[model samples]
Target: MTATVAAPAIRVQGLVKSYGDLRVLRGVDFDVARGSVFALLGSNGAGKTTVVRILSTLLRSDAGTATVDGFDVAARPGEVRESISLTGQFAAVDEILTGRENLVLVARLRHLPDPGVVADDLLERFRLTDAAERRVATYSGGMRRRLDIAMSLIGDPPVIFLDEPTTGLDPQARLDVWAGIRALAERGTTVLLTTQYLDEAEQLADRIAILHGGRIIADGTLAELKRLLPPATVEYVEKQPSLEDVFLAIVGTDPDSEPADVITLEEQR
Candidate 1:
């Protein structure tokens, strides 16, 4: 008997887009499996964002086809929008509103019943219950990002498109966002993430697609893609803690540090 394979939650084939004389996407194709994190990794100007914009129905592709939840993005734009939520590079949050109020606002916008209850539940889920009443302007970058992601969950859309979710965040804030993303996949939400940071993709994606010059040059699981490189030769090198290590040990920082201390300590070496 032949085994049947499940269809991807999102699919794209021969997708092409251009801005006047510039072609941002050239025959891009990929698949995002259900309940998985699929990362589109590339550097700046590699058309990662363009692909995202097209898939989310915010922009039309010049050619090819894309489907979300089996609904054609071009032919059925309404249904495509219904099946997905998009979070852009920077958090699109209202700075004046309290975190709790932001969640309630989104829930109400989606016309969900018991909006307050929904907001309360999400605040607890994202570990923002304590900061819920504080204005977003006063919250840390990580807190704002967490609340931003929390707001996107109001309607429980099946697929989420996160465009460089941690772009400007500090290390700790990035880690916090990473944890939230893991939680989303664990709960069966399909996440499509686009980022330029290799480590970010390494840390988050279940499968990765390397986009270069407007095309997918590589696509596979982390292990599968790594195998494309030349075989590694074993080498043993002494492991030593650098000055940054000692500095962190003396005073916790790198995230919050004294520039004077950094210069003084490193200069001594």
Candidate 2:
């Protein structure tokens, strides 16, 4: 007996997209294995969002093909939509509504049998139960982002697209979102994330593709990408005291002088 290979959750081949004469994606090719996180890394205007839009069926490509969960994005848009959820750079929650209301709204829109039940379940899952009744306006950035992702899961889609999910978040808030993303993959969901932060991709993605010049210049795991570069080289420089040290020394030598205001390293930058 022969074993069968599972189809990839996402597959793109020769995918091309353009607006007027400005081409975005150029022959980009990659595959995201089922039940794993695949990150697309690129600078602004490098076509990361274009790829997500194409895969989510929000935009049609000029040439080539993309499939999500075995459904063609262009040819079977409804089927593709049924299998995927998208959370773009900005959180889509209604500010006036409470977190619970937001989730219930999505569940109702999806025509779930019991919207309240689904909403409560997701609130528990995302650890938003305590804040479920609080207006989203009062939630922190991380809370709102978690609720945004929770809303996307209303229909339990097999694939999720998160475009710059942690953009503008503080370090702790970013880590919270990262934990949520990992939990999704742990439950067998396929995640495709686009991010500008290299460390975000390094910490979350099972595989990564670097987009440059409207094309995927590199694609592989972090280790694989590292292997593509020259071998590591390390050099150490002798320690030198900063301006703070010099100021402290001067102050100690001359107690008669008034103390200077403390300056942070960031202020120097």
Against the reference, the lDDT scores of all candidates come to 0.91, 0.91
lDDT of 2 by residue, 1-269 (tens): 99999999999999998899998888999999999999999998899998999999999999999999999999999999999999999999999999999988889888899999999998988878988999999998988999999999888899999999999986656867898999999999999999999999999999999999888899999999999989989989899997646655645533235777776789888
Q: What is the lDDT of residue 196 in candidate 1?
A: 92
- Tell me the TM-score of model 1: 0.90
140 in model 2: Cα distance from truth in Å? 1.4
For each candidate, give its TM-score against the true structure: 0.90, 0.86
lDDT (C-alpha) at residue 105 in model 1: 90
Residue 41 deviation, candidate 1, in Å? 0.2
- Report the C-alpha lDDT of model 1 over 1-269, residue by residue, as the tens digit: 99999899999999999999998898999999999999999999899999999999999999999999899999999999889999998888999999989989998899999999999999988888888888999988888888889988889999999999999886667877999999999999999999999989999999999999889999999999989999999999999987646645665543334544444646679
Highest-scoring model, TM-score: 1
Clashing pairs in 1: none
